[model samples]
Target: MIKIDAMMVCLDLSDIDEKLVAFSRTICERMQVGKVYFVHNIKLYELGDDFREMFGDVDLAQEVEGNINDIVDEQFANKTAYEVLVSEEPNTEVILADLVKRYNIKLTLLGKKMSTKSTGSLGTKLLRILPCSVLVFPETASFNIQKVLVPIDFSDTSVHALRLSKNLSDQLGLQLEIMHVYRLPSQFFPLISEEKAVRKAEEVVKGKFADLQKRHNEIAGIPYTLVRAANKSIAERISLHLEKGRHDLLVLGLKGNNPLPSLSLGSVPTEMYNTDINVPLWLVYSEEVIK
Candidate 1:
């Protein structure tokens, strides 16, 4: 059984449509998370005279506590479930990180509000800094993971993702597909005269991932498809390739860089997440996920 010692839960009315408290309770039961810190952040008025009316004696702190209790009492009154702590931190990362360290959090479960545009990926941003595994809830994510996509870069982190993916696939009887996008410089730089670049790149991708695929069969016990693409723009090329191959879930191992804040919200993962990818993306870093 996976253990969840502490979990940071964020609820914002701006993007949330359903009763977040109810879902929180259900999540606790399903994932077996023991303790959760229910956090409701109220951003200060930021419009220039468009919306600066002060709320009359309306203490958002007290309201957030009441809502949390209501969730416990109304949803799981007889369940005698886990504990929910209350905090008043308004920043998403600050609140979540404080609780994570205070309670020695192992996993975090988060939900997104259906605003016109999301604050990019809160999980991606938090994952860069946080030391725990985070479960990012999409608009509609089901308990059953039927199909899984694992994008390989032949890193230890990629194998770690496969390790987790293999366990999940076993639990849900999922079909996992291995995708390796082979970038061709010919497709990228038409003017450059490195005629052998494309061929060398192809050889490299095949050499890297081909062995990893065989290792999966020999060890973790997973069957997957190897996808190759000759494109320049890694992010856009990935999106197009995903369109060609129908997948329900995307698994990736993030590597390199100190992690620019723009890594997720501005780079490949962000491009895929912001756009209509028709699936959920699961990213794991080598240090975060054990191989």
Candidate 2:
């Protein structure tokens, strides 16, 4: 049986009124995770001590309370609980950490672009610290996993992402579209026709993956897709694969020797992550696997 989970989105004050509510709705339906909580940290620092003390002039508190209810009711009418919690804490990072423990949030979806690569971005810091699976979507990301692109190099970390896909496939009732993008002709012995190299690489990928595919055939929810594209750089092939598949989520393994670092949260992932493609991305850490 697949365990149910919560989908949390950090609401941005600047954009919440326009796209935030609709974005929450998209994930809840497409991913089929019922407990969708739109979290907003309400800080009392904004309100002066005089205002805080006077229940009569507590206008800031009233406005926040109203917005929370409006967002919950308007956006998540179908969810089991459309909860909005407030606290005096200034940091969303700290607040969400507490919520993860109290509510057992399985995954958190944040609308953070990859532009801010520094360690100081709240979302970036949260990604490092959060106990749950965190999805940092591009500013223009849409919530859907219609074609979940799993970039498998067959490492343990890759398998961890695949396992998360399996669990999410069960809950969302989605097709687990698996992709393996790799290369061959390792040095020396050069008979390098790009065409011939393509055929050779195809054979290598299939030869290695035939049994792994056969073993997971019981996973009916996931519709398997094996893509073998030839490119010198792994990142280039991944970007090209995304172009062809229209994949909604890029479920990547944490570690691989393939010239690029999946867990580094750097260029390749960050490139797609920073785009306006409007697709939700799930970054699964290797050790967090529920094996």
Candidate 3:
């Protein structure tokens, strides 16, 4: 099981901070997290030339920390051991990586803005830099988890993610389901009709699932679905399934069996992170697997 004893929440002094703080409390209560760290980065150098003159003798770091404390104390601090970390460092990824290591953080929560079309944000970088797992909450994400979905490719890493999802689902009394997106090989496209191709894909997936159950007994009784990607990408198919099933949370493994002993986010997850998926995504990274 993934140990969520300590989690750090990245906050920017924006509208999403409120939702991030509120959701942090929910995660602490549900996952039995012992400590919560509210972290923010204030790039003082990037401020306007007259920033200090305008705010004369004001400690910007203190002020920012105070603001975060007010929200965290009001919405979150009472339930768990909490601290506010406000940094003036220009490199956010570096500071966050240090904090995670110093605090032995197992999970990191970040808020993503879903309005834009770009994804070169700090959250995306942190996924590749930090050794711990990450959970991202879109601005419009709800504070509840009624249904959870885990998209797997039947790799050991994905199966491990499924096990974690199963444990969480059982603990929270929520419905849990797994989905696998399959694609018909192009070699058989001309020889076989679309119907036959789909049937063959389903049959292959069923057999694979049966083999997976035999290998991993913990996933035997959980419900699973096989989605065939006809004209859509794997990420698109998963997003469609999430919307159709009303699943508020998505859990995925970082990558399928990578030979290099380093962290790398897979294409599907990287795509989901970059696009406007409009849901909270949990990317489970097993440092031990790569190490």
Candidate 4:
């Protein structure tokens, strides 16, 4: 029952990934969104003196809008209502943030190509500044919604994520899995043997998991698991879980324990973005649902 009225999709017209378009279309259909805004930002330098006159007196924005509409018609078959916007703003991030506010956008979709070196600073900034949720789709990601994995740490944000994931799973009839990864303190276990330390840590993790399950048993009526890794980073442990499990998507809660005044996402999600994991990611802000 999460109501998303409008969604903004950032597109790089010069390099359009078909997978990104397909995934966006699938989300639009599933969410039953009424309006989809396609936004593209261009540098001021790209506009030459003759460029405006070259298009038979058509403005630059109009020309770009026409092209975007054509692409949408051909690629997406015009499934949902859409608006095309082309901005000449030098800073794309600022323009995108402004559009999100102006349009009351509830979600933003960013496409990541496999060939790109990184998501770059723009992706990070958007995740931080945007008031709504953000979903990133890699070029190799599939549109299918099957099994979903959500990492939790018993925070309010984690509980909010679990609630949203449960709603989504119920709506889509998809399998949901909740996982918690714990790391044992190295210095505290120095007096005990490694085997005993590991056993104690497992017991502690199980106890915590059981407590969480009891608290949210109604929402998480599905299967859930707990993972314990002594030395591995949280991102590494999550990567290992994704490799072993058949999960197709990852739903994460942003601004969990480390709440930043400006940024919505925390260290764990930021690190996951930098990893080689190709699964599509859905990030839910704490304020979006926990309020």
Backbone clashes in candidate 1 total: 2
* Two-way TM-score contest, 3 vs 4, winner: 3
- Evaluation by lDDT, superior candidate among 3 and 4: 3
Q: Pick the candidate with the highest TM-score.
A: 3
What lDDT does each candidate get? 0.58, 0.62, 0.85, 0.77
Clashing pairs in 1: 15-113, 15-114
lDDT (tens digit, per residue) of candidate 4 on 1-291: 666788988888755444555677888777768788888887857678887567555566676777777777767765688887888888888889889888988888887765465545677777777767888887667778799999988788877888889888888888999888877677865687878877887788778777877887765466777787657888888888987997899988887334663555777888787676778888887564423
Off by over 4 Å in 4: 46-58, 115-119, 256-264, 288-291
- Per-candidate TM-score against the hidden true structure: 0.71, 0.70, 0.93, 0.88
The TM-score obtained by model 3 is 0.93
Per-residue accuracy of model 1 over 1-291 as CA lDDT, tens digit each: 344566655555433414445555655655556676655555444323433455555665676667666665775543424555555544667766766777777655556533465665565567666655555556655444467877666667667777777766665567876666665545556566555765677677767666765776633345444344543555565666666776667766655344454452225554554554545566554444421
Per-residue C-alpha lDDT of model 3 across residues 1-291, encoded as one tens digit per residue? 334778999998888888999998888777778788999998877988688778877898999999998988777855688888999999998899899999989889989987463354767788877778889999888988889999999887798789889888888887999999998887776788888888878998899999999988888998999888878999999989999999989999886255542336778888888767767999987666534
Candidate 3 wrong stretches, greater than 4 Å: 1-3, 117-120, 256-263
Model 1 root mean square deviation, Cα atoms: 4.8
